[model samples]
Target: MIKLKAQDAGLSIAELTRRSVLLKPLPKRLSKITLATYRELVRIGSNINQLTRATNTAIKMGLRPPADPEQLEQLRNLLQQIGRELSQIETEITDDDDIESDGDSEDWE
Candidate 1:
């Protein structure tokens, strides 16, 4: 019998011990779409942070920051698009769970 070491299997000791009994597999890797969404989120976050810092600096200098209506609209549209994409992804995940549960029930019979 071949012994499987945690380190050899590229898993932590705790994860190996815990999962060994239950025999549950690890979660799947992030899909490309999910990764791209996260990257977009980070980019948007950085842009907002830069805007905030600029606004703060202007306030400290007693100068009013000029706002461009077009930029604001673009940010608003980007946010809305992200929200829609997240909702769609969430729906897909929920649907997958439902299908898995249905299949599990058939296995019991």
Candidate 2:
């Protein structure tokens, strides 16, 4: 149908597409959850930083950390989990790019 319209209007498909783009805006390009996951990662990283600072402060001042050995082990586990999640997000983003370039790349014309 677009080809027909472009032919009838005596305009190349590329020209029609260019004019349409000038008249309207493209939608978001990130079609994935990577962005949200990144934001969550930032928040988690900040919390972990604060926890580390507090623990260090307590130790420096000759007080036991509120978080003992067991708690520290749990924190380590949480960090490992977060690392795995980050790796997964990275893989997903890479896969999304691969998918777009997987013989589907096309010129608008």
Candidate 3:
């Protein structure tokens, strides 16, 4: 459990042990839904990369892609939406972090 918590906080086991002795608060993990959304984003990004590579290859070969224009526009819109979603998720996580920090660090110790 201590190792897991330390990993989540990007700390070494030694650092985590030191924090524990000092009663320092640990960083919180994202909620399950947030993690799931990130996973879905990665999956979608992989698909987009495949599509982009195919499109680029076709262009380089002087081949006109049948669904090129419309598909590219859709991908652009999707990328914008993904950016918005990421920003929203970041804001939510930042807010949560701020809430945790409202308490003084000395309180934890």
TM-score-based ranking = 3, 1, 2
What ranges in model 3 sit over 4 Å off? 1-12, 20-25, 73-77, 90-109
TM-scores for all candidates?
A: 0.47, 0.43, 0.55
**Candidate 1 Cα errors over 4 Å, as ranges:** 1-17, 66-109
The sequence of per-residue lDDT tens digits that candidate 1 reaches over residues 1-109 is 1133454345677876777767776434333456567788878867766776776677678888655545755775787788678756754553234432333222100
Q: Rate the local accuracy (lDDT) of all candidates.
A: 0.58, 0.61, 0.67
Clashes of 1: 0
Which 10 consecutive residues of model 2 have the lowest summed lDDT?
24-33
Cα lDDT of model 2 by residue, 1-109, tens digit: 6785465345787866776678643222332355566677778777766777788789899998856646766776886787687666565453336443445343233
lDDT, residue 18, model 3: 88
lDDT of 1: 0.58
- Candidate 2 error regions (>4 Å): 1-32, 89-109
Worst 10-residue lDDT window, candidate 3: 100-109
Residue 93 in model 1: shift from native, Å? 4.9
RMSD of each: 8.3, 11.0, 6.4
